[model samples]
Target: MSSARWIYLDAGRGLAALVVVHHHLMVFFDHEMAALIGDESLLLRAFRGISEWNVTAILFFFFISGWSIFLAVERLGTLNGIGPWRLYLLQRARRILPMFLLSLLWAGGLSWAGERNFNDTSFDVLVGNLLFLDTPASLRGLWFPPFAGNGPLWTLSNEAWYYISLPVFYWAVYSKIANPLVRIDAALLGSFVVGIAAIGVNAILPNPFFLFATLWPLWIAGYVYGTSFGQTPIERRVIFWLGLMALVTWSMALEIRSDTLRILSDGCILALCVVLLVKIVRWQTQLTRLHYIDGIVRLFGSVGRGSYTIYVLHYPLLLFLASSRTELGGLATSLLGMGMLIAIAPHLETRIYAHVNQWFALDRPRADA
Candidate 1:
């Protein structure tokens, strides 16, 4: 992919993060916002409509994550053995865990300072969150809510499982079992056992396994797209058909009452979005050089690099500000919260992660080494 395409991808991700931020701001201060801007105001109505895009934004995150992970694994070469898999896990952990743990601490501190009893912060919940067992309660299973009301943590659990699954999937696909039929049977049987186990787990313990299983295909779609990106020439007609299908699925998602079917529809929508994003990047690459557009894309790229920090930390900060009973208007408070998050995100995500990586020697090995 061209550098321009990479920048555009980053811009897309950054824009998605901003969408999530806007949605949460709208939700967190809905009453205050109604008071500030009259309840019937067009602006307020528009904000509410925009807030509904949070789900799509999150799905975008999932698609990009899969694409990035595919690139990461390819860059690392084959995970043919246990050592490579361990290293991959370590690297992923280094990138993800520090900020995640810090966010938990931040949320806990905010809850304590605010004296808010709204969230479950007990030891079991903390452990569950740390273990990435926090899933939506609608999944028909025992589930742990996000600790201290950090609702976004649910996506992190899904992300972590996807990370872990990629290596396993790679290993299985590239395994030494040479017989194709035997391999197929093994894969199917293993899947069957896992499904049964997941059913049992849902009946017993807090189960995030099932939720991840449901969304796993969306990630796989992205990985497939990434692998075929430059090699395959996609026609505009194909994209149109995919978009049409996405629309149909999305409408079905809205009209259906079944949670599982709705999730499947959302997955289809996200998979289609991945294809659209690729087309968008290609289109951007063909455009004439526009300095203003380039500058804007670069700014968003920077934000995208820090997007994880924004996702994990924004809610706690917003909650804290909201709970403080400050004299600032809702708009001012929301802007302040966003500003603080943007300012701090790059430092926490890049600088702090770099420092932690070096301190722990978790950096990927040099190709020369």
Candidate 2:
């Protein structure tokens, strides 16, 4: 990757990391701070609004992930035929499995350390979390999860599912299929139809699994852009404009429909991301330094570089906040928590990942993975 591309990745990854932090903070500390800060305060409402958009941020990250991965495939395809499928899976597992296990253990340990009752339900949660299975619907609210334990692991599972399934997508849509564009179009159309069907079922059945199907478009969109990244500046510009429009339309939809709209909104946002990423790759400029802002972005990026580690360790910290005696102010608590994580991220990457990697036999030197 070019230095410019690294800069773009750093910016997005930093923003994603901070959003993940805020998402956890809102669940753990925001509610407590609301009463303390003033129940009817505008500041509280503002915080609440941002909190509600955490899922949107997560969806954006997924979109970016898709775009990045597709670009990788494109780059590789020109060289050695994109290598072997088994090697790809092994690399992905090495990348994700260490962090996933650590997060699970972090959750289990928090339950023990915080003196939370680890009943039969807790045991089941540990297993479910470890296996990346859907948490029993019964435990959904047993404890607030976003900030507490490995709640973020849910996304990891989705990501893993996507990674594992990519080969099939490549074969079915982009490679083996006689007409790749037609296959892409058909897949997207079928996914949207499925999403609409899920919405219908959700009206009576309330199954959120339906939402998982919606991610197909985002993943495919990312693949398409990634495949085309180095083709030409004009083509890149086309993707960029399309992505921008998708984002604008999605934002407008958010105002129009809160429930069902997110389904389509996310799809549009995913497509928009591909375009935006293509533009970034083609047109690059350095940010004029804004003293503290640059410093903070760099710090966030440093922590984000070990996103896997920070993500794994973050839940335990949340559980600590939820169960501990400290009654921290919202802003103060959030800043402190982030500061600690920023400080600890390097340590986790260095020492903790090693410990977690033992079981998975994933302690390969960072460069190899």
The whole-model C-alpha lDDT of candidate 2 against the native structure comes to 0.58
- Top candidate on lDDT is 1
- lDDT (Cα, 0-100) at 78 in candidate 2: 40
The all-Cα superposition gives candidate 1 an RMSD in Å to the true structure of 5.2
Query: Which segments of model 2 are wrong by more than 4 Å?
Result: 31-49, 71-83, 118-121, 135-149, 177-211, 230-264, 270-274, 277-299, 327-335, 350-369
Query: Which structure among the candidates has the greatest TM-score?
Result: 1
Can you list the residue pairs that collide in candidate 1? none
Against the hidden reference, what TM-scores do the models get?
Answer: 0.82, 0.72
Residue-level lDDT of model 2, residues 72-187, one tens digit each, is 44434442254667656775777677667666666666666775633333555555555545422322112222223456666675577677778877765556555544554554
Runs with alpha carbons beyond 4 Å of true place in candidate 1: 2-6, 174-206, 233-256, 280-284, 290-293, 329-331, 364-369
**How would you encode candidate 1's per-residue C-alpha lDDT over 1-369 as one tens digit per residue?**
434445666776787888999898987788878898989999999989989989888877876776676666666676677877887787778767877899899999888888455477899999999999898655665468888888888888888887888777766653756654444344433443453344445445635677567566556555545555654343343344345545655685576554644655676666676677656756776785557877888888788867888888888878877767667764687688798788777666767866786888766321100
Against the true structure, candidate 2 reaches a TM-score of 0.72
